[model samples]
Target: MDQTTARPETQHQSVTFAEGLTLDCGRHLGSLTIAYRTYGTLNPAKSNAILICHALTGDQYVAETNPETGKPGWWEQVVGPGRPVDTEKFFVICTNVLGGCMGTTGPRSQHDEHAGQPWGTDFPPVTINDMVRAQKRFIDHLEIGRLFAVVGGSMGGMQVLAWAALYPARVFAAVPVAAAAYHSAQNIAFHEIGRQAIAADPDFWAGRYWEHGVTPERGLAVARMTAHITYVSEAALTRKFGRKLQDTAQISALGDRFEVESYLQYQGSSFVRRFDANSYLTITRAMDLFDLSADYGGVLPSAFAGTKTRFLLVSFDSDWLFPTEQSRAIARALNHVAANVSFVEIKSDKGHDAFLLDEPDFHRTLRGFLAGCAEHAGLS
Candidate 1:
């Protein structure tokens, strides 16, 4: 987590599509590249694939030691040999999303149409559907006729839902954990605050800070701090840090020496080291624009009018960001369509981030659901 530490070079596994793709915004990216990592072997029938969609800040390292951070994969606890979404029995593929910094084609990637400079702000606006479409191209290239499962949390969960909606016949099971069918107003407000923080930094340079040979570290760090606060519950913050005071040497900019402030500062500093400011802006905006019901004339059930894809929607009790009520609403819509759906609101103190943590109940539910589907699919 050291800001001064030099991370190792990224060893990317990616494929380029020269045919390119047209974006939802009508912009065409010529020769798009998608970086991903696959764990477990693809079965001969190609029916064991399970796509892992990461959150806003997550990369493709779902079940291995991350080369850049040297840290264990994000979901290593729930995705190993005997875990919930066991890689030993499933071809687990995780991709750094379209506007991601971990080797995916994004705002920081060089513009093919431009004269080799990074796209920066010139990058065309993207939506959640665009991200799912991009992933579909990669899956088609891999010759996967259908994915056995699609799983994700937060923004990644949005992509999972989009995948099921756009290609219902392709996804046998869709798990959207700690996510909603649409971004809430408060969430959009939170994102705007972070975006303003980035823009307010003079170093942002209109999202072209790389051209100045400087990162908008201060702005990006503050933005991360803000978002991180939303990820955890107030009870968790109190339980972990209380009003505990940090040493005077670690006093914050506001002159407070609280332990929580120090922790958030550490998080922000570490995030800036691994994430791109423009990519953060791009992804958050995409999340804000996500409205799965918009395509169905605001009738949520109509979106899944005839979906055969089974759904498991997970929510955390303390997740104020995307509350259980939102998950319930989606479940109700799925029920209205008589689509196979199950919803579970996990009992956890860890707010919106409960899905990422080691929650036994959540894991049990996911495991049982996937196991049932695997049996139905005859994977066992």
Candidate 2:
């Protein structure tokens, strides 16, 4: 495999895993490719690199315009030059995770052994650790010894934790925001509903939608609507819509009448335009299978035993989906293992999505944490 790095300014690049990658499920990919993006510059010492992982539905476009959406990056406000991540001073890298749809090897990507056909449902189920393993390969391709920091929110946060635990020496600092060490039963149930919604769509064609030249748009839309509700807080919904009708002063239509309903409908419609239904199933299953304790003989603290990686865990006050309790649980485990850790729960009604929003306190907390980490790493 060619081990050359993409140009520093490359917004999107692909790295082929020619030796193929074996997933946790015992499925071996004959060949794999990872799509990624980079920002800022890697200093002479190469100690200024930061890996920014994305959440469940997010792709590699971190602080640049998304070619697919024709819109500014999802985290543009928080990751540009001089922002919290400080791209000007730190080289930032974000990759579309395994089982993602954005130009990465996923259900939508072509299968090497089967020419002109996508893996679709045949794509093996993946776990958070598998995603991290693939990313480690990507970093090795760049010839970087260790990352200055690994930062992510939600599922991305899970990846951060995996990096710190599985490759402690390779990470100097780790930040897992709005994330949990394992998916809760309620979370798994919600995901199951979404997956079922997609499967039930006639167009899904038993995960062979690609062959049928049709997409499971309606099913995917419903799934997005359900997942979007979990991303935001109930308080936020009430504040933003407050049972207000979409248009008239009184109720009229039977479907999507309220403002919140209309908003959810728009979100669902927009999501299907960019996401693949089979990819959604694969990724959500991976998230649901994440269990740090399982790898450590049912002892969660043992997972972080003797770890030297500095840790910063953040949670939102209203993020009931992956609430403050989950972050506190991780903090307790880290403390038990004598790990260096700091945890904070920001006061916000934005819920799990607060990490992506323009929350002043969240930004300040992140900026301070990264600054301290950079100083400790001796990166001027």
Candidate 3:
């Protein structure tokens, strides 16, 4: 369960491709290992496959006990038998994305040609398109011709957009929850702050910390803490922690005086235990580089011109990170092209993390959307 170390094969299902992948940066990976988890049964026709992309820092333990954290799957609330994304009716496939630390070919993965040393920063700079390309290859490996749906939020939602735009014919329904077509300047600035924090750590070793017998956990933790703030709303934070003190007693200089401080500290510390610093650098770069509309001369509609895929875009009212306007822009683009698409702004106080939380309205919307799509797709 060491986040930066090689995880045993028993921890998850994986497949290695000898030819590897051609990354967006034009580097060729000789051997690719995709660690993934599948829930429910693939129908005989293989038409029920739903690729559930994970957000940043998430792994392939979608509906199982996470081997590293020993906690229920991140989406356990919505993706189980008799739940919203019912396993009884659909097959769910989640993979540890390229540039991730969890059993995938990433910064921590050994370079096949180089042998012992890890890829570290040498791992070819990955893009959102690159991540989706890897996922598409994995789906082909599973021998699934087309997917019933491609679903995700935040970073995962970016992947969903990439999937739909890159391979529209292969996706029957695309649900990008709490996502945008490109990285906003503010989001990029936040990510830059995180990267700076990691680099400032003396133990970072220019991202080659694996050779130094130490990890840049402090810097990584700080990055997590900073980013975690953007994941929730001020309203939610006030309701949960507010200005309450961690202890009623008078505190020392370095002591965590505020309850919020201690909470973020716990979050940061716990994150470093289950994540790798170098991989964090690699993945965030990928997220920051994502821009679905730039390829088509900044015309978002041109990207989906003549696309056959059905789209359902969801956003939370309080999600300033990937706000309602972003989703609306996408909706307008799809409308311009007369593509099948629906956009919704779910009422919630959870901010950007609303899709991952226990919001009944979000769950209902998802269930209803998928159900309607299933009927259209001839799913029983």
Alpha-carbon RMSD, each predicted model = 3.8, 2.8, 2.5
Q: Identify the runs in model 2 with alpha carbons over 4 angstroms from their true place.
A: 1-12, 248-253
User: Clashing pairs in model 2?
Assistant: none
**Model 1 C-alpha lDDT per residue in residues 1-380, reported as the tens digit of each score:** 00111113765777777787899999898867888889998999999999999999998899988887776799897787989999889999998899887887898888777775888987888899999999999899889998999999999899998999999999999999999999989999999989999999999999889889999999999999999999999999999999998667464578757889889999999988888988999999999999999988999999888999999999999999989998899899999999999999999999998899989999999999999999999999
For candidate 1, the TM-score is 0.96
lDDT of 1 at 328: 93
- Backbone clash count, each prediction separately: 0, 0, 0
TM-score (C-alpha) between model 3 and the true structure: 0.97
Deviation of model 1 at 283, angstroms: 0.3
TM-score of each: 0.96, 0.96, 0.97
What Cα-based lDDT does every candidate model obtain?
Answer: 0.90, 0.89, 0.90
lDDT of 3 by residue, 63-85 (tens): 88887677789999889998889
Q: In angstroms, how far off is 372's CA in candidate 1?
A: 0.3
Q: Which stretches of candidate 3 lie over 4 Å from their true place?
A: 1-10, 248-253
RMSD in Å for model 1: 3.8
Which window of 10 residues has the lowest lDDT sum in candidate 1? Answer: 1-10
